[model samples]
Target chain A: MNWAFFGGLLSGTIMYGVPLLYTTLGEVIGQRAGMVNLGLEGILLIGASVGFAVSIETGNPWLGVGAAALAGALFNLVYAFLVATRRANQLASGLTVMFFGMGISAMVGRAYVGGGIAGLARYQVPGVAALPWVTRTMFNYDLLVYLAVPVAVLVWWVLYRTRWGLSLRAVGENPSAAFAAGRRISALKYQAALACGFLAGIAGAHLSVALARTWTEGMTGGRGFVAVALVIFSKWHPLRAIVGALLFGGAVTLQLQLQAMGAGVSPFLLNMIPYLLTLGVLLVWSGARRFAAPGALGRVYSGEE
Target chain B: MSAFTSPARRLRGACAAGVRVVRKGWAIAAARYAIVLAIALLAYAVVLLLAGKNPLQAYSDTFSFTLGSWYGFSEVVVRMIPLLLTAIAVALPSKLGLINVGGEGQLYMGAWLATWGAITFTGLPAAVFIPLLIVLGFVGGGVWAAVAGFFRARGLVNETITTLLMNYVSPLIVGFFVYGTWRSREVGASAFPQSAAFPEAARLPRFFDTRIHLGLVLALILLLLFWFVLEKTAWGLKMRAIGGNPEAARRLGVRLGLYIIVAMFVAGGIAGLAGMAEVSALHGRLRAGFSPGYGFTGFLISWLAGGSPLGILTMSFVLAVVFSAGSLLQITQGVPFAAVNVLMALILFVVLMKPRLLGRLS
Candidate 1:
């Protein structure tokens, strides 16, 4: 492939990867607090639709992002009540939330088909966007591309450096110990799940309004689930999750590029690459080392229990 | 004075305790069904009102369309065939505590494989080719499911995620063959992405003058087989034990991994058969949207029925009725097909939230 082709691949990969980065990072934070929100996909769908609608109505992308986050938080509230308070089965409840969110979003977004909203405009930092190759490859992109990196770093700092992170990790590892230390375990878990929802919502918004620039039914396109897979692949590390997202993004970009080239390969088989890669990664990772999940993950822990 | 007071006091205390327990149990069940029903009504009202029609009228139309005509009734049964098969796919693995969300993928794989088989062996006798195609479909689904099981058993990878991710992968594989390599030349239409039509020999026999076929009978047979295996056999006993308490079952000498794998295989095989039935009996070809979300709908039904085989049949027919009605609602009331989806989701949410709502009520 020529340099131009390689550059196109790089740009496409970054665009594709940004959404996964947001979601996986969000999941990393949630999992650190010992809560697995399988409803991440649901949140994404709601976010995408709501974000697209709001942005189109107001002509402000930031407003759309805020609305998307609120939608996600609202979805998470239902999940928080079920898994965190009532102690329903986490997986089942998560799946229910997913179905509900998907249905609701599709219904709500039916009118917004073919509508386009301006996405986050690319920021030109002093001479960065001016560079010949690097400009298009890196600096010339949507605001989400810029936000994804800092978000990853920020989450890492909160998880490892802050007292709140310590409390959250403690709650995940052993809620009893955290409760003994005067930490409100349930409160912390609720907060973490809500935060995860917000981030996931932003990811969804990025996909529809920012990236695709249009709203369509079921537009999240399994990216949210892919983010969950990335979390497992990254072993719940924020920075590593970003890397995993880029890897997946690269796979997606490759598929598109191959299609564009008319390489005689089936686009259908090419699309399967990322999922097959995820399964392969899980198998390989599990075989190499025992990835220690949060002890309280997916379990409803009452202080009494 | 002591004898009279003692007997009366005992009787009053007994009545109070009995009333409390009974009230609690009834409250729980009531909350569950009430939530589901309320959601269903709310969704219907919203859909009908938005379309500028009365909800009751829309619903009445739906019912009439589904039940009023022999033709419509046959169509409902035809729709129920795939739903029944997919429900069995979900219900089987669930017995072992494994959720096989990859049924959609498996269904596609089976349909794709069956189409390939049918087209390749076009001139064979119906008796020989038909059975071979069905078996091929079963193998296709079974092998796809077994891959997930292998990862779960040996790698300790979570089956839920693995199965879910596999779902995304499977459709693409099917699309690749239909769109790229196996695109029908005779039709010569890029807009219609579908495989070559299956041969006459591979086609399933119709049940009546309607499109309903032997697939419905096969679905009923599978339901009975599943019920017998789950309720009457040693394998059923082991599956329940594995699902209920895997660690305890393992200590008791149950081969946890083996049974899980087997359960998944059976689940996939049933799902595959559903796909084959759709291709052979209904559409006579594999096309995009051939499954028409039947796999996901089946998941909802299987879940609603709590994995009961008889319940699967009942729920499948109920869903089939709703679907038939929904399509009719679209034609008469201009309500979107998605309205039905909203209702289904609402019902599922109510079911999931029922216990807690009841607990609070009591």
Candidate 2:
């Protein structure tokens, strides 16, 4: 209702949207490159827990983010080998990795509960923080908040404008043809998956350090799956992922705000908003446009195939 | 003599070729499984060692907790109820190349509906009420899963993601009811957000002087029925055809969309039965967070079994032991319940690799 309230909500959206954005963008890259890492959530969980631990141990959040990315890449490499190289069922293997990630995160993070560590330090723009218009909306967050958009735009360019992006898309659309055309489909796929994992790690680290600012088991809180859904809504485009993530971010923020408004609504119903919106968007978007997944999307690709 | 020698030499060559082919396939298949099992065990051992605990002692403690005594055996049976039924939920859909990961959601919906029925129909005899409640639970879970199926059929939405997201919704729906309309105001249960206990008339009868109830019998019967349907029936054949290749099945005039919806309904219905049995037999009340990842455990079970009906039972027993043991380990060894979760997940990863390698080898 008020300007200040609206400004706070916008800030909250960015804060929440950054993690979702990172995940969706990463998923788009993986799915577009013919690998759907259902293990993205697992990667996030592992990343979040490991990142938190590393950051706590090292006394630096950036180091935590770096460790998270490394963990994500290592975890995703398994998926790349199984689904990409071994040609296993993507859905099953992805789900398998997810369960493993969750289990491992819980197993490792159980000790970190109540560890009481400082979170990511907000790097406010010196002049921007003093400005009346931008102070609440943009100036008060970690560096990742600023980095997310430019990185997304860069991903958008690489996906559409670059020759390597063309080959990557070709690999997803038709691996045999791409292979015949002298493209290294396997190499492209591995790169895409690993890069996606790196971003997922950053997303997980953001959730643990910048958002929740503490270690808790399974704390990624289904955001990875939400990001997976977000990619479909984005139609595998990096730019659209940004929009989808923010919209979801807003939808979630609105729920909390509505609860704060004391509008005689049950908290249980409020919890349903984000999930319901995801399903609703999925249904509506499918009817509106055929969300054509990569032709070779979940298939195992060997050069022979 | 020359003609006889030529014929004998040809036969010997053919026999050697046959043996070589058989040995190659068998060796690869064996190696694949061996590698997976070895790796899973090694990883777990490494983790245990890192934690400064002895894996062997933990395993033995887990052993005595689940497999060593009659009481432990009963606990295993109790754990297997929701687990096997929910595994069927995934197994059924999987046969049609559809992944129904919403067993958790369906289970909660079933329990919620059964709870509602129990409270609303308090006057009926247990015989009448229990059957009525079971049907409600089935339909509730069935319809919940069917929503994802319908969207998949008509909207072309990926059922995997839809069902996964729906899982998050169903529990909250249950929460809305129990926390609102079904919240018991009785002094004993008022502090908790839960439904009132089912009337004595509505409770399920027990078996063998233990907490293991009639649900175990129901699960066994259903598992056999599941085998019959999957292995021998026309519908089962059709499901296998669809899963094998949907385009081919559709070309043969199989109604792909309808079959998918039906498969999901059947899957959801079984999960619902699990939820109903859990409440009516074991808890007698609907409480928040009632399921501690039983649906996910079921998903793992179905994957481990590779959708084979009888295989589910065997895998279920093993996991039931692991689960019962994990809880015991949590108390006796002061180890986290998560260690079991980790171990189960790793087993799934190892098993999932088996079929892929088997195909390559054999």
Candidate 3:
């Protein structure tokens, strides 16, 4: 392949991968803290619709980004209350919240569809952007793409290197033990869920304000679902989430590039590539003996005796 | 074995079993469902208010439009054709502690294979070819579902994730045919993205002067049959035992993997029936958006019903009524279909109210 074609594929990966990274890392945290937000797809929709609308109205992508995260957090507040305090089933509750979020987003987003408001403006870092080879190959994306890397690293650090991370792990592994250890297991779960929701919101903001630049009903498609599966495939590790997201991003970009170069297969058939690859990865990874997960992954925790 | 025992001893055993039946279970269940239903309705009312419509008026209109009229009631029964079949697809797998969320994908494969039968065996008599289409639908969906089952049974993959992912994939394969090779080639209809309309003989016959098709009869019969199997049969007890505790069942010599595969195959086939109904009866031709989210809706139905066949039937009718009126909500109140989705979501959320029986994942 020509260098220009290769560059286009890499750029596509970055565009798609960054948002996935945000969602996957968020899921890693949520699952790590003994909760699984099946409603993530809904959360992303809310974030995308709200983020896109606010940015359009205010003329500030940052404002849109903040609004998206807030929307996600507020939505999760209800879910966390139900699952954490009300002892609802995590899986069912997440699914409900997901539908609720999608409905709310669609109800308001109908007006904003097809309105072409500009996305986040791209600006170059002075020294880093000017490097002879680096400038041409990297550091050339929107600020969000660049930020995703460090944010992931920071998440990794918190999940592995801090006491809070340890407490979260304890809760995920054995909530009863964490409770006996004097950790506020339910409160920690809510915090983890809320923070994860905030990240999912930013991920949606990336899709609307920086990538697709438009809002649509269920625009997140199955990517939110993909991210949830990615967390499991990566074994709930933060850094591994980045790798997994990029690998998926690369698969998607590769197919489009193949189509552009006149691949003979029908585009609809070609669209199955990423999903097939995901299945393949999941099948292979699940075969591993070292496949570890949070002990109490989907169980409802009981704080009282 | 027990039925062959002496009559007097059997009477004593029957009395003991009757005593074992939890009478309080019904009252507790009713109370739990009441609270959850109320909360879900409250949530729907909140959405109605936000849309600037009077919640009470919209509720009355919805009831009158869907349940109050003969036409609306018949329409609800018609919608329940697919819902009924798909709900069984879900409940069967769930009884084995597996979430067969691939109902959507299996449904798609059913439509595809049934379409092939309709198109290929064009010269066959209506009676022969119609049954052939039904068989093809079952085989197509059964095989598709068995793929996830094989993975979960042999590959240790989580059925929930795999089935959900496959659900996203199956619709695309159908779209490929509808949008490309199978695009209607009739003189004036080649412009539309669909198959050539089936011959009259290929169509499923409707009951006298109504939209309802024979699939409704078949679904009702199957529901009664499956309920008997699930409640009174020896094999059904084994399936439930396995679902309750896989490790214990394994210790007791239950063939875990084999039963799981069988359960998944049956689940997928039942779901396939839903797709067959949609294609063979309602749509009359395979097309895009023919059965969007039908599988997911069925999944929610089974979960709401808590795996009871009768509960599934009742819940299916309730949801069918809600969906039958979804369009009226759109036409009259300027609400979106997402509003119905909102309602379903809220209803599903209340399943958590009584977690032990309904929301028990495994």
Candidate 4:
């Protein structure tokens, strides 16, 4: 209601929403390329664990972020091998990848639990920093938060503008047709997988190295799933995903704020807000957005094989 | 009429025929399962070695604890009860090309409603109370899953996402009640977030002085019924038709929406029975987070078994052994319990790859 409350809510939204935004952006790429990585939760965990461990060992958060990104890309190759190469069912493959992620992350992160890092530094925009209310809410954040929107824009540009993007879209729209037109369907899918992994890993790193600033087992929770739902919410568009992620982020921030304020609602019930909102969003938009999905999305492409 | 055989001879002939059928296929199926297990274990052993633990010792410890003792073996059977029920929950819907991933949520709702019945009907006789709890559990889970089925039926949203998302919500709803009005009011128990203990009559009867309960019988009955309906009944034939080709089935006047809703409801109801059994027989009370991912494990079991009745039985037993071994490995290998997931995922990966080794026989 008041300025401080409103400002805090807005600031919290940026802090929490940024990670979801990055994940949504990553999944947007993968889904657009006709692959759906349900095992994204695992990807995020790998990034979070590897990022935190490297940061702790090297005492350089940037190195940790880099390591996390590479680890994620590498991990995704396993999923790509199963889904893209072996022609396994995508949903089952994704779930297996998720189980693998959960096991590996727990094993890898056991020693680093509760360990902290001098995480990404926050910066304030010079002019906006002077404003009374806006300064507190919008001007200051870690580098990832600042880059989140621009990256979404960049993703949109690449996905919509480039010739490579055109080939990729063609492949997703109709792999057989794309193959006839000389696009390498499997190769394009792999490229999309790599890009998706890199972004998802960065998203994980943001959780450990920037937001949480500490490592723990299962730290990413189900945010990966929320991002999956958000992709449908955004109608598979990068620009639209920015709004979807922020709305989810706002829902999360609102719940935490309400719980912290000692509102009469049980904290357990309050925790349901984001997930319920995801279901609600899907229910409302999925009927309309069914037409917006890539034609060959979630299907295993056999043309190249 | 002159060639008519005696009843005893006919019975013997039928038994021989059944044996011949099993002989024809089970060898290849058994070999495939054995190879899958070997590969999974080899991969998990490598992980153990990398983690600086002795792989041999971990395997030995797991087997010694789970397979070498009667009590441990019984525990596996106990674990398999819920896994079987939930697996059937998944396997049934899957027969119609529906992915019922909300087993966990359905299980919780079943337990929640069963608890209500147990607490309220405190003085009822065991004969009456047990069936009451069973019905309540079934209704709870059925309604929970039907919501998702309804959405899918109306073509509003995919059941996969709705069911998956709803899985996260159902537990919180249970938590809300368990932490608030349902909290055990007993002075010493207030610290724990669990409901009051069920009356003696509310609990499922156990067997052989072990934890194994009547849910095993219920699960076996349901599994047999599942096989019969799918293979013998016209309803099952309609469902298979729908799964094989929905368009053709629709043209034949099979109500796709009705089948979807009813199949989901029954599948969810089965999963609910698992929850009810766990609360009444295993824990004797409703506790927050009572299940350690039994519903999810059931999904994996159903998938690993390819949704066949006998396959469900075999896979549930195998995974139950793994579940039992998980705790032993934690202490002996100095690794977290989650390390079991690696083995599980590996098994699934091998199966999902659909290896050509058994291509001819399968």
Candidate 5:
């Protein structure tokens, strides 16, 4: 491809992939704490709808993002109770949270159907935006795009290099041991989940108010679920999660470009590319014994031992 | 060595102990369901009161709307067709400890394939066309599910995400066709987009002059067949063994990889059949909103039933009643159609929270 085409492709991929990256990074933290929040999609939907509604009402996109984060964190409170306190099955509880969030968001969003809200204003780094090819790809993006890379790095630092990170990892790896060491396992789980919710909320807000500039039913469009897969594909590493998001994002960009080119391929078949890729990636990752998951990923610890 | 006290005797004793353990486990499960049911009802009453409607009247209306007339009953059965198929779609994979959330995508694929079959075979008789559409739908769903299964079995990928992502991908595929090559040219509607209608020969025959069609019967037959397979057959035993403990089952000579793929394919095929039924038997064409969230509803039903076929049938009907009545409540009481979804969510939450409401049955 020519330089211009390559630049266009890179920009398109980043624009499409930024939301996925944010959510994936958020989920990487949650999974590190041994909690799988299947409700990510629901949280994203609520965030998108709420963010759009609030921004339209207030004419402030920042407030909308904050509201979305609050909504997402509030939703996770229930998840924390079920998975961390009640000792219920994680998978089942997560599914329940998902359905509940979806229903509530749809109900809350009903009045705002077809309504549009102004999205975040693009930020320009004076010198960077002036560059020939990289300007459009890197310099002209909303605040969230800038936030994603740092958040990924911060998550990596918190999960690996810090004392808090060690405690969290200990809880996920062996809750009993963590408890014996005086760490509050449930509290730590709640913290991770709430943090995940906040990040996911931002991701959702970015999707509606930044990327699509509109809210619709089921608008998150399974991006939350895709984020969960990205986490696995990244092997739970924050930086790798970004890479995974980019890969998925590239697939999505390719589909859109192909559709635009009118290449005569059925759009349905074209749309299947990302999902098919995810499946392929998951299969390959899961087969490698060296990449096995943490010892106690889904099990609930009663602290009996 | 003592010939009378051999390793076979120890194996038999171990088998007995395993049976006892399973029985105890069932007992706990049953008690959990009982508690959940009671809690769900209590939550439902609370919601009814909060909405400013008489709890008794609202519930009565719900029951009457679902069962009062032949038409209402037929609608319930028609709704059950998708719920039944979708439940099986979920339950089967769940048996293999895999969550196939991609049922919605599989359903869309099935509908797309069925539509293709209908459009391409315009001159065929109903006898030839209907079965072909059904088979095509199953094949479409099966293939869709198999992709995820193959990834899980061979690629070591997580099935949950793969299946879920498939849902978005599948709908876009349907959207592409309807918005492009398959769009009906003659319709006057400005807002809604859909495909060309299937010919009469491709439509499913109605059941006893009611809106319900033969699809319900087919779903029920499949449920019965699956129940027998899961509960009585050697293959079912192998599946259960794998589900309960994959490592142990593998040691016992079960083909873990093969079963995972097969189970997912079967699950997806059932979901596909639901899509086909929706197109041929109910809507007569594929549209943007053809599913009405049946895939997710089926997920709820399967979980509520705890993966039992009989339980799925019962819960599907109950869900159908709630769905039908929700629509009625919308028109009569000015409640949103999604209010019923709220109730379902409440029920699900309470059931999962307490899990002791439906004593000795789950």
Candidate 6:
């Protein structure tokens, strides 16, 4: 009710929202290229585990972020091979990649459970630091949080403004057409998968190195899925994803805040809100947007066919 | 010469031919599975090698622990119950081209409702209560899935996304009850978030001193029922038509929406039976987080099997062995239990890659 409470909620939203925005941006790019990496949860787990381990060992969070990104891109190649190269069913292939990610991340990160590190340094916005209502809460955040919105914009520019973007979209919309136009469809898909993995990895980095500051088993807790839903909510637009992620982030933060505030609702029921909300949003949005999904979204693309 | 043969002799000749055809079919299937499994195992061995573990040792230990003992074999059967039901859950709807990833959620809901029946109708006779639990479990899972199916049938949303999202939500709903209203208050067991133990009547009849229970019968019956309904019935033909071509089926006057909704409901109900079995026969109470992704595992099984009953049966047994081996591997291989997922995923990937060897050989 108070300004302080509202500011705290807003701040919490940014903290939670940044990673979601990153993942959503990545998904938007991949989906725009007509590939949906449903195994994103696995990618995030790989990134989180790798980032947390590397950060703890090196005593530098940025190195952890880089390692995570590299690991994610490399890990996603498995998915790229399956769905893009082998022309497997997208949904099934995505789920397998997810299972693989889960297993590999758990295997590698096993030694680092309960591990901690000096997290990413938070910075205050130089000018906005003096704002009256939001100064203390909203004006201070980690490096990733500050970069999140700009990254969305950058992704927007890359996907919407570049010729490469155009070709990627063409491949997604119609692989045959794109191939006829002289585009290497598989190559574009692999590139999209890499980019998606890279961003998803950073999103994982934010969860471990910058947010929770520790590694736990399956710590992402289905946030990868939340991001997937956010992609739909944003209509596959990176710019729109910023708002969508924040909204979903608020749903996540609200339950925690309410529990902390000694709200009467069971925390378990409250926890269901975000997922139910995603389902609701999907129900509402998916019905009307017959054209939103890329025509080749889940279709397998066999080369020269 | 055939024209001159007796009628009985000609009939016998035709029966022999049918038997030979069936045997040949079995040989081809066995060969295909053998190849898929060998490739999967080799890939997993490489993974083990990279992780600095002895691939040979891990495989041997997995074998001896899972297949080497009578008790181990029984446990595999027990594990197969849920895998079989859940796989059938996925397999049935897949016949109609619908993905029922909500098996996990439906399983939870089924368990939740069955728990209510178990706890509420304590005085009912065993025969009555058992059937009641079965009905409750089916309805619980069926209705939950029907919501998603309704959406898909209405063209409002894809069942895949709705079911996936609902998977996250259902567990939370179960948690609300288990940790709240349905919370067990047994002495010295308050720390556990679970329902009170079901009465004696609610417990499914078990086989010779093992966890294997009536759920096995239910699962077997349903698997047979699924095959029969899909292959022998008019309804099955309609569903197959829907799966093959929804637009064409619609033009031919098939009720696509009704079929979709009904298939999802039945599929969800089968998965619900999985939940009921797990809680009633295995745990004797509904516990939070009881399933370690049985629904997802079942989905993989159905996909790997390509929705064939025989394939589901074989894959579920294979996965059950893998599931049992996972815990043993954690101890012997110094790897985490989740490592099984890697192996399972490897198997799935191998099948998905669709190597030409099986095709050529078959």
Error of 5 at B145 (Å): 1.5
Against the reference, the lDDT scores of all candidates come to: 0.81, 0.84, 0.83, 0.88, 0.81, 0.88
For candidate 3, give the lDDT of residue B147: 90
Best by DockQ: 4
| lDDT for model 4 | 0.88
Error of 3 at B232 (Å): 2.3
Estimate the Cα RMSD of every predicted model relative to the unseen true structure: 5.7, 5.2, 3.8, 2.7, 6.0, 1.9
Instruction: Judging by TM-score, tell me the better candidate of 2 and 6.
Output: 6
Q: After superposition, how far is residue B27 of candidate 4 from its true place, in Å?
A: 1.7
- Candidate 1 chain A: 10-residue stretch with minimal lDDT: A130-139
| Model 6: CA > 4 A from native | A303-305, B1-11, B355-362
Question: Among all windows of ten consecutive residues in candidate 3 chain A, which has the lowest summed lDDT?
Answer: A130-139
Between prediction 4 and prediction 6, the one with superior TM-score is 6
Candidate 2 CAPRI classification by DockQ: medium
With a 3 Å backbone cut-off (N, CA, C), the pairs that clash in candidate 6 are none
Instruction: Give the range of the ten consecutive residues with the poorest summed lDDT in model 3 chain B.
Output: B353-362
Across B212-317, the per-residue lDDT of candidate 3 in tens digits comes to 9978987888788788888899888989999899999999999999999988888898888788878888777898768847788888888788778767887898
The residue-level lDDT of candidate 3 at A3 comes to 66
**Which candidate model has the greater DockQ, 1 or 4?**
4
Clashes of 6: 0
First chain TM-score for all predictions: 0.95, 0.94, 0.94, 0.97, 0.94, 0.96
TM-score of 5: 0.88
DockQ of candidate 2 compared with the true complex: 0.50
- Candidate 5: residue A262 lDDT (0-100): 91
The digit string of per-residue lDDT tens for model 4 on A43-116 reads: 99999999999999999898999999999888888788887778778888888888888889889888988888
Evaluate model 1 with DockQ and give the value: 0.44
- The DockQ figures for the candidates are 0.44, 0.50, 0.63, 0.68, 0.40, 0.66
